[model samples]
Target: MDHISREVDRTQELAGVMSKIEMNHRAFCFANVKDAKFPLVGGLYNSLERFGDALGHNGPEPFTHADFDGRIEAAKAEPIQPLTVDSGLTKENVITGDAINLHDLPVPTFFELDSGPFITGAIGVTRDPGSGELNIGIYRTLIIDRNHFVINASSMSDLRRIYSSWEATGETMPIAIALGVPPAMLIGGSCKLPPNMCEFGVAGALAGEPIQLVKCEDSDLLAPADAEIVIEGTVNFSNRVENLLGEFAGQYGPEDAPVTQVNTITHRNDAMFYSIVAGRHPEHNTLGNVAVYGVQRSIAASIREVAPEVIDLEVLLEPAMGTLAHVVVSIDKHSDAQPRDIIERIFAASGNIFPVSKITKRIIVVDDDIDVHDPVDVRWAVWNRAATETKFMVIPGIESWELERAAKAGQKSVRIGIDATMDLEDIDKLLRPIIPGIDEINLEDYLD
Candidate 1:
C-alpha cells in the first residue's frame, strides 16, 4: 500500500479496537518487550513504545505518509469520534497532587535506563497561555512518583513559554494528556506546527474530516474520539523540577523539569496504555516523514504551479538529531529557467521549521532519470551524470532551524546543489541496457 492506503488501514486497525490500555496490558508493557523492527509487540513495544505496529520494509513498499493520511480519512468516516473517560486518571485536576488516585492504571517502564514509568505517546493538550489557543504536542511524561509526572518543557520550547505565562499569574497551566490516539493524530502532533494552526486541524486535513474533539473533564480542550487513555491535570507553577527521562535522541535530559499535578484519571473501564518506542526504526523514524509530506506537498503544489514536472521528494530525519532536514525535488526541468533558483526558493520558504538539525548540505537537482531514494543509483548519477564542480552551489550563514545545533554557538552551514541529469545533447536518445536472452529463454526452464 502507498501513503494514502497505509494511513487508511491504520485507522481501520484502531476502529473499535479495545482502548490502548487493553492493547498495552495485553500485548506489550506488561509483557517481556524486545527491540526489533517486527519483534512481538511485547518485546518491541517495551523498547519501542512510540507507535504500536513498528516495522520496516525495503523495495519501495510505500511512503508511511500514505498510511497516516489514509487512516485519517477512514477515521473521519466513522459515525462518531467518541470520547471515553478513565478512573485513576484525574479527579478535579491539579498542578500538584491529585486528591484522586493514579495507581489504579497500568503504566509501563519502556527501557531499563528510563527514570521510571514514562508516558511514551501522551498527547499533551495545553491552552497557549499567550494566545489562548489549544496546543497539542507529544511531550514525554516522567513518573516522578505516584501522583506526579515530570513535564520536560525544556526552556527552549514553546511549552516552556506557555508554562512561564501561567507561572507569572500565580496559576498552573491546565493540561490533558491523552494516549492511543489515531496514528495520524500522533504523526500530526509530533512536530511544532504554525502558531495559528492546531494539530487536530492538520489531522483533519490528512484524515479528511474535522477531528471530532471532546471536552476534557477538567479543562476546556478537546481530544481525539478514539484515544484510549487520558490524564487530565495541570502544570504546577511552583514545582519547577522533576526527574528527566531518556528521549529518542539516545540521551538522558532535562534532569529536572516542570512537573504536572494529577487531578483526575478517566478512561474506558478496561483502558489500554500505548507508548512509541524511542529507538526502533520504520515507525521510529517514519512519523516525521509523514508530516513532512504534508508540508512538502503544500510547498510542491505552489512550486509546481510555477514549475511542472517536479517528480518526487525524499525527506530524511536524523535518527539522533535534525528532525526537519529535507532533500527534495526530482523534477524534469529542461530550461534555463534555473534549478538553483527554484531549489533555493524552496529552502527559503519554510526552511527554518522549528527544530530541524540541518538543511541538506547538498540539494541534488536531478534529471527524471535518477531515483533519489536509492543511494547506489544516486551515487551513479553524481559520478556518471552530474558534474559536481559546475553543478554544486552553496548558501552560507542560513540557519535551517534555530533550535537545531544549540550546542554549537557560531555554526554556519552551506547548502549544496547537484545537477544529476543526462546532458541535453543526449537526452532524446539515452536508453538503459537490457539483457539479450531474457525474453527468449526463461531461467526457470534451464534450472529444471
Candidate 2:
C-alpha cells in the first residue's frame, strides 16, 4: 500500500486520488485528510488477488463454488460467540453527544451528484427486535450532519426487514456502524444470509476461528472488536430522506431511508478511516462480488434441481448491468432442446437466497466443451454455434431487479435466453478447432 502525505479534501479530491489508485488496481492511504483527525484508506480489496490474499487463498479465484459451500458449512458448524465489551476499538477516544461530529472523520463525497458524503465501507449492526438475533450488513450511509445520517438498506436486505419490525414498535432502533473491520467480516457482512444465520458466524467460518465482538457503547448490538472506528446510533422510522449515491452497477442508485441520530463515536488513537470508492470502481465491484456467496450459489442449485445435466455455472457481475446479472451455464447436452429447457427452467426457478427471475435478465447455455468463465469463448459460441431461428428466446414481462434502470412500469422487464450450444445434428461440424500439443508447447523456451 502506498501512502500519500499531501492533505486532501473530504469532497471529490479524496475520491479523485482513490480513482487513480483504482485505475492501477492499487491500495492507498491519504495520510493527511484536510479538516479531519485521521487518514483515509481506499482500494484495500481492489483486485481478486488482494481479496483472495485476505482470505488466505493466494491464487486468482477469490470465491469458488467449493469455497462458497465451505463457507455455508462453516457457518452452520460455528455459531457466533457472545460479545466481549473490552477491545481495541476504543483504546484512546470515545466522543459522546456534542463531541460526536461525523464531518471530522473525513467522509468522502465520491461523486459530484451524490446527495452528500457517504460512509461506504462501514458495516451496520442491528438486532432483530423479536428474535433477539444479531445482524450485520454493509449499507451506504449518507451523512446528513455532524450527528446524523441516513442508512440505505435495500428492500431485499435483512436490515430493511429489521427496520420494519422496529418501526412497528414505534421505538428507536439501536444501531452501530463499524468501519475498518477484518476482511472476512466485511465479506461475510456483504452476503445475503438466511434469516436465522448470523453473519459473525459466517465470518468466523471464513477466518477458521471465532470472530471477536464488542458491545456498543450506546446499543446492545455488537460490532467487531478490532474495528478501526465505531459510530453508535439510534434511528426511528418517523423521518425518511431520499438520497442518491453512485452504485457498483456504474450508475447512481436512488435511496429512500430513515435518518439515524449518532450518540457516540469511538476509535483508536491513530485510526485510518476506510472508504470504498463508490461507483464502477475495481474495489466496489470486487467487494460487491461477495453476492456470489449467497445469490449465485442459490441460482446454481435451483438450476441443478431442474437440469441435472448442468456441469458449470457463472453468474457474471457485469458492472454496467446493475443488479441484473448475466448468467452462463455449461451443460452436458444430449439433445438440442436441452439447452432451451435448461434456460427456461433457470428463468422460472424459485431461488433460495434471492429470486432468480428478478436478478437474472440474460442467460446463455453452452455445450460442456465451452469454458463458462471465458467471455470471448462464450461469445464465440453464441455467434458461431447458435442458430438464428430457434437458438434465441425472449420472454416479456418478467420480474425485474429493483435497481434496474431500464425496467418498465410495475418493475417488469424482458428475459433473454440464448442456446449457444451446437445443434445435435451439427455437433461434429461445430466442434472447436484445436491444435495438437497446444497445452504442452512452451513458446518462451523456443523464443529465448
Candidate 3:
C-alpha cells in the first residue's frame, strides 16, 4: 500500500491521491493527516482489476470472463463461518455519551455542495426484528450533530425492509456501523448476492478465513472485530431528522431519512479512520461496479437456465450514463427473433434477480464478438448491428430503486432495450476480415 505524508491537506488531498492511484492501478493508504487523530485511507478497491487480483486473478493481466465467473462461484459456494470472539481490537478504546464527538474522527466534506461530512465507508449492520436475519450494507450516513447521524438507504435495500418492520412494531432498531474493515468486507457489503447469503460469510470466503465478530455493548448486533472503529447506535421509529443527504452520484438524496442516535464508540488504540469521496469518485463507482457484477453474474445464470443462448452480461456502472442504469448482454444468436425473446426473459427475471432488475433502466444485447465490457467494442457493435427503429424498444412504468427517481415518480420508471446482435443468416455476407495471429503476438517484445 502507498502512503501519503501529512503535508497534504486532509479535506481534498485524499481524493486527489485516490484518483492518481486508481489511474496507476496501485493500492495505497494515506498514513497521516494534519490535526487528525487517526490516519485516513482510500483506494483499496480502486479498480476492478485490483478486485480481480484479490479473487485469485493475481497476474498482470485483465480478468477474463472465466476468471470472473470462477471467482463469483467460489464466493457463492465457500461460505466461511463467522467466529464470535470474546474480545478484539475494536474494543480497545471505548467512549460513551458525554465524551462522544463525531467531528473528532476527521470525517472530511468531499465536495463543496455536500450537505455535511459523511461516514461514507461504514458497513451498517441491521437485523430483522421478527426473523433475526442479519443484513449488512454500505449506506450513506450524514453526520447531523455530535451524537446523531442520518442513514440514507434505498427503498429496495434490505436495510429499509428491516427499518420498516421495526417502525411497524413501534420499536427502535439497533444498529452497528463498522468502519475500516478489511477490503473483502467492503466489497462483500456492496455486492448484491442472494437474499439468504450473509455478507460476513462472503467476506470470510474472500479473505480465505472465517471473519471474527464481537457483539456491541449497546446492541446485540455484531461488528467486524478487525475494524478500526465501531459505532453502536439505534434508529428510532419516530425520531427522524429530515435533511438532503449527499449521494455518490454527486446529488442530494431524499430529504427524509432515519436518524441514528450514537450511544457508544469503540475503536482500536491507534485506529485509522477510513473515508471515501462519495460524489462521482472512483471508489464510489468501484463499489457500485462490484454490486453490478454480482447481480449481473447471478441474473445471467438465472436467465441462461431459460434462454440457453445467453453467454454473458455486463452492467456498465462506471463511465455509463448513470450507475446501474445500463446493461450489455452477449448472446450466441441463432435466429432473428431470439434477441427480443432474450430481452423479455431478462425483464421477466426481475422477480428473482435483485439490483439489476430494480436499478437498470436500459439494456443492449450483442453478439459474442462484441465485448460488452469494452465500451469501444460495444459502441462499434451498436453502430454496425443495430437499426434505430427495429433494434430498440421501450417499456414504461417500471420500478426504480434510485432515491431521486422514487421521490419524484413514486418509485416508477421507464426502460429501454437495444438489440445489437447480427442476423446469423446474413453472417456469411457481412463477415469482416480479421488480422490473423494478432492475439498470439507479444507487442512489447516486437516494439516497446
Query: Which model scores highest in TM-score?
Result: 2
Instruction: Report the C-alpha lDDT of model 1 over 1-448, residue by residue, as the tens digit.
Output: 0011121111213221212333343333332222211111222222223332432223344535455445444433442222233422222222334445554443445544666656666778888766787777777677766677876664334576777778887866788888777655775676555574566665555544556676676777666655666777778766666554544444544456667877766564444556555433334444544445444445445545544556876654454534334464677767634666666665555333332224344456666657777767777776776554666666666554333343234655556666666666666565556677777896787795
Model 1 root mean square deviation, Cα atoms:
9.7
Which of candidates 1 and 2 reaches a greater TM-score?
2
Clashing pairs in 2: none
**Which model, 1 or 3, shows the larger lDDT?**
3
lDDT string for model 3 (114-216, tens) is: 6776788899898878777677899888888889988877755678777888899887788889899987788778767666568888888888888899989
Ranking by TM-score: 2, 3, 1
lDDT per residue, candidate 2, 258-310, as tens digits?
99999999898777899999998988887777765567667778887876778
Query: Any runs in candidate 2 off by more than 4 Å, and if so which?
Result: 57-76, 79-83, 320-322, 332-336, 433-448
C-alpha TM-score for every candidate: 0.62, 0.90, 0.81
| Whole-model lDDT values for every prediction | 0.54, 0.83, 0.75
**Candidate 1's TM-score:** 0.62
- lDDT at residue 178 of model 2 (Cα atoms): 91
